[model samples]
Target: MFGYSEEQIAAFGLSFGVGAFILYMLFIIGQLAWESKAGKFGTFVMFLGLAFGMVGYLAKYIIRWYLER
Candidate 1:
């Protein structure tokens, strides 16, 4: 409860959508890692970029977790 109105809360949802995308990218790292191990260097680079993008989202999650305590 950040004390925002319903509309404001909905607006927050938009940001959360972005955060979710980051998490999804992180999850995709597994697939990329596998491809890399299989000798697909190009796919590995692509996956690494995606996982890096997710780092910001992962940081957000960490912050949220700490705040909840």
Candidate 2:
């Protein structure tokens, strides 16, 4: 579709979906910190913990890229 192969189209859709999900997760984390009255330090800690999944996903992609290359 739109001149892209099926794999490329699927990848684009999945990438957008993943990006939206990550944004929603971050918003929820921010709301949690605000409701809990977590100050700057606490908020930082919350994000650090919450972002580990994203960091791991990124690391996996990086490792895959290097290995594939």
Candidate 3:
């Protein structure tokens, strides 16, 4: 396509886009915990809130795989 193969595009999307987002979310969770002095329960809640998008993205992948089959 745009001077890159499908594999190259997919690799960049997963490795850079999704991977960077996950890393940023982890940083956010850690920062929330540290700045707020959140205890274990609070930290868990923060993670669940912040990381839900990532979880949904993964779930979509799984759902698509199953539906395609």
- On lDDT, the leading prediction is 2
lDDT of 1 at 52: 67
Where does the lowest 10-residue lDDT sum fall in candidate 3? Answer: 52-61
Q: What tens digits encode model 3's per-residue C-alpha lDDT throughout 1-69?
A: 889999999979985799788888799789979899999999999998878778877787789889999
Q: What is the lDDT of candidate 1?
A: 0.71
The local distance difference test score of each candidate is 0.71, 0.87, 0.86
In candidate 2, position 64 carries an lDDT of 84
TM value for model 2 = 0.69
Tens digits of per-residue lDDT for model 1, 1-69: 677899888867867877776667667776667756746776667666666656666687789889999
Q: After superposition, how far is residue 23 of candidate 1 from its true place, in Å?
A: 6.1
lDDT of 1 at 35: 52
Q: Which candidate gets the maximum TM-score versus the true structure?
A: 2
Stretches of model 2 off by over 4 angstroms after superposition: 1-6, 59-69
Misplaced by over 4 Å in model 1 are 1-8, 11-16, 23-39
lDDT tens per residue, model 2, 11-41:
8777777778888898999999999999999
Write the number of the candidate with greater lDDT, choosing between 1 and 3.
3
